[model samples]
Target chain A: MGETVIALAGNPNVGKSTVFNGLTGMKQHTGNWAGKTVANASGHFKSGKRSYTLVDIPGTYSLTAHSPEEEIARNFICFDKPDGVVVVCDATCLERNMNLVLQTLEITENVVVCINLMDEAKKKGIDINLALISERLGVPVVGTHARKKKSLAALVDAIDGLPHGKEVCRTDYPREIEEAVKIIEKKIPEDCEVSRRWLALRLLDGDLSFKSEIFEREGKALNHLQIRRAVSEAKMYLDKSGIPAENVGKIIASRLVEKAHEICDGAVTGETGYYKTDRRIDKIMTGRITAFPVMLLMLAAIFWLTVKGANYPSQLLSDFLFGLQDDLSGILTKLNAPSWLHDCIVFGVYRVLAWVISVMLPPMAIFFPLFTLLEDSGFLPRIAYNLDRPFSLCNACGKQALTMCMGFGCNAVGVTGCRIIDSPRERLLAVLTNSLVPCNGKFPTLILLISIFFAGSLFSSLTSALILTAVIVMGVLATFFATKLLSETLLKGKSSSFILELPPYRRPQLAKTLVRSVFDRTLFVLGRAAAVAAPAGLVIWLAANITVGGATLLQHCSDFLDPFAKLMGLDGVILTAFILGFPANEIVLPIILMAYGAMGTLPDLGSTAEIGTALAANGWTKATAVCVILFSLMHFPCSTTLITVKKETGSLKYTLVAAILPTLMGIIACVIAAEVMRVTGFC
Target chain B: MNEYISLNQIKKGEAVTAVRVSGSSSTVRRLTDMGLVENSIIECVGRSPTGDPAAYLISGAVIAIRSADAQNIKVRRRENG
Candidate 1:
């Protein structure tokens, strides 16, 4: 049997990916769309002896080409001409979704309307008349609770039946639109594969479809002037009908909406009044009085939980990994390996790898799932809704709030999430400022610094947690300021307005969120950090072990940096450690510990007293701790984030800015902090 | 009495009928495409914590619109007789 290509299309936040995942199972490849930052995922499935390749297009509200995602989705359906298209709709909000479905129908007849989220709809007492909708639209309607595998079988069956399905019912437009479309339709070339009526409607609606895009696949040059003249004539004809040329698009959109309403009149019934639960929750969550405080408390709570949960596991992992070094050394002694090789491999390479995993993994494993829970519960959009004004004030996208939240888990992931912002200028602002939020890797260092220097005697853990939150709050404020400055100077642009949809709050799928965050986020970030840390560990080992003149290479480098580091309230050893820790932030403190010769390997700071004694021995004061913490919060991103920023921006210049901008900030901040502490005699 | 006003002027929990959606082409296209066409009923259900962009119940979807954008969407208050 011949293979079939199916395009999955839908409105944003509708469970299109759910249905795609249900059908394709685990056979999927996710990559950026050709020459576009937008991510595309494609997979294959088998139905009744036929292999089907499913392309999951980005979720878009319309095919009007107002945004890249919408354009990509529209281009795939119109130009690619897939064998079947599954138009997924949110069952709870079928009316709004019908606009996209109607648009898809105008392009291809081999389409199926898959009403997803049927479980949510059923729970809300919304009954959808699938057969009635199918009859009305003249396409197969498959009701699916896409999350449940069993419920998707009918949807798969509908796709299988697409080859034998009835003729697609074209949406009837208003009289003025129909007359203008007829004029434009006569001008479209006869050999075009896209539906003539769709092309005519697009031309009338002032679509920006380039002539090259129209016939690029056919290797033919289209008569661009002919199409433009035909479109203008259509608009002129509609203008004579009293609808202005500028308003033609609205009129066409209204006609399709009117048709959607007509179809929904009898096909959708039941108590749609049960949004009361979501409303009741939103009342507190987004209420002006409670929102800010609640947001702060939530941030602190997640951080505190991560700190508490990761402490023991990180210690155990470190102990276990370091303990393996002794046994390996014992085996090496029997094998008579060179002393330098043993030391380099075990102490330098293996130890740093272990330290990164032990320190970075536990926090990320805890933080990412907590973050995903907020996302799955639909609270992240509310955060965007609340912060939209502030972001607008900074001339950035409100969606930056979502990306910033992702940054808290890892800045690299946050940089990737910047793709959601439509405007390139705003996205660049987001990408550059994303590193201001301290990620999971930096948490270990911050927590250590705070607990050792700032934790008060009374309620130490709570005090440390509050101080940590304050530092994060400071980082967020800095992000806003930096974004403002960048917008004003480097990347000037008006703030783009967006419709932030606060999706209906549902019970978060805890199990799926955990598995997804663990593998997709936590493990992915850990793997990247480990890959960089291994080579870094070897370098750190070589520097420490290799002798230069009378002193070791590490000692010589630290000696060279001493004066500058001293001016910044740090010493030569600490500055050299920070520079060497560039590959991953998780190894910074461990590097410092190793350089201090406090321990031959990364030491778990058992208590604030032990950490304080070590720092004190190195000429550290409260001022030094303050400067280090500030510097740690503001410094250049780790190697992984820099690579991600480079990949995302695709420019060496911006990547350099991403690295240098924060480093400059960190240096200035440290200098000021150190000077203030010195003048105040606090040191 | 039906009084024409911008959508931003509508009070929380106040239901209105969309009279006309006029703004930047993209904004207008987006609003109308989301089923906020003429005579379609919309309700201001909630407001953000900072209280600029309010959530409106439109076509069974909760869409958050900033006050600036909301000002462009003219609506008429639906008074219960």
Candidate 2:
């Protein structure tokens, strides 16, 4: 026999995901806020002799299908026909969570109510009478602190004892609607797999613009002639009463909300006192006077930590990796491997792969965890809340700010995160402008340039970090500018409405978040960079080594791009390096160093000052460094982001637009900077 | 009779009971789904700097509703607060 399939359902911010992870032993990113798990995640777990397939449906407020996520949650519960459903509810706020619970009960009798976050509830001085509620709802209810595995044992036990015949205490609809529901239920086919009561509610519900969709989903079961006649008859009966036609959906919703609160009267008790602690923190974090400064300081602190924390580890890693190249070369020589093969393998592929890992790993390891910490603590939603007004001024949804934050990690991720924006036009706008702000992959190069030219020797790291923060601010402003431009011209539309939920600030699970984020985001991005870097290193090496007439192919290409590069206050070698860094941004600096090395005038690379001196010898000016930073900031996204864009939008045209928009911006910005420097005699 | 006011008109730290949520737009539907039904208590907890979206405490959750959508929701001040 197949495994017992159980659908895990709940309202937003209810720890439904936490429960899923506890049961399935899956690392389904438990970021505790609304809409994090938009796409359903399915995993398997075992209990005693029985195995269960658990589908974690998106957290939603209702089954009424007001949005895509809700629609998904609704359709899954109705049509999927799982063996049993485990509705996870937030114990601290069961009243709101019950809205989804009673609606689910209306559909299925095989429900095991898992009252999750018992710890949070207990902390809030809220108490729930689980046994009483279980009896009231005619379902087995288990209380659990989802983070504690022992607490989840009761939940697993309840899943094994899947309750049947839920004599659920649901609110009765008003008499007119009740009469209408009865008529519809009487006409619904008994052989129908769908619950008769649920189907009746849908059939009698007003203005179901997606009625055909539900009917189509149920495979014509509710589309029968008798059901239609009964529904219209019920509507006539509703009209005969004082209940207006349009008021049907509203009235039905009101009953459920009332019923949910009523059910909680004896079962759940205690006020969180308007979450006083969280409210106090929100006053400062999202306060009108302090919000922007707090935001900038938070961003700056994270970057400062990332920059400071990553330096030693990065240096050590590169030293170890690059130090091994000579041994590899010596081993190749002893094995009588061809010089070209040895150079390609040791000096080319191995060196690049090593550089990518050493450079990308530490910063990502530091940055992603801090970012995840913010995400876990509910601060990110507040950021979206605070920024919504400004973002809306661009004619884009404020959620774009969330996606932009994701972009600070990686543009590919930013593009995927664009899924949170509902409107196609705004999502497209986000996708197109995402690469304007550099990802962590671009940070190594940006930092190197800043330290060399902008930051004076004293407090260099601090100065560079602050300058990096300013550069990020520049990128953010550019994002707003570009979004506004596109919204006006290409992707014009009114901003779609989204309910921004500022979830109560829970203490972030610090240790757990750090460890999981390292595995989830840091290593994943590093793995991709390493994959791209090795092959790219080999290609760049070949381009530099392979001679064309008098000069190497690398030199020839640079010479060809030299004049245009100068127009941007950069030289040929820098331009060629940017072009070669197409596969991954991590290798751009290494490529520049390698090109300079080929000229035989570059010094051995180690310290920043020594490298700066080498750059000066190679005709690099402060203006050149500034231009390089500008170009790097605004240039086309890596090939990975482009492919992601293509896959996301399913349009080659937009993918090209994503690439061209930033590159054009970079060229214009660099040329203007270069011209201004020349005119001002600053170059 | 307690006078009805648009939700945004309620100042910060004020609590009100929802009388009726008008309109059939997706926003109103979302508001209803999130437990802004008639007689449900909503507290004005905070406001954005630009004064467009005001965050309300409803059903044990902080939900930010823009003034445009807040106008659809009619409420009366709660004496308790």
Badly placed stretches (over 4 Å) of model 1 are: A1-3, A27-38, A209-212, A215-221, A456-460, A598-613, A650-652
lDDT (tens digit, per residue) of candidate 2 on A377-468:
88888888888888888988778888888898889878877876756788899889999889988987887788788887724578788898
What local lDDT score does residue A209 receive in model 1, on the 0 to 100 scale?
Answer: 57
For each of the candidates, the C-alpha root-mean-square deviation to the true structure, in angstroms, is 3.2, 2.7
Least accurate 10 contiguous residues by lDDT in model 1 chain A: A28-37
DockQ of all candidate complexes: 0.72, 0.66
* Residue A482 displacement in candidate 2 (angstroms): 1.6
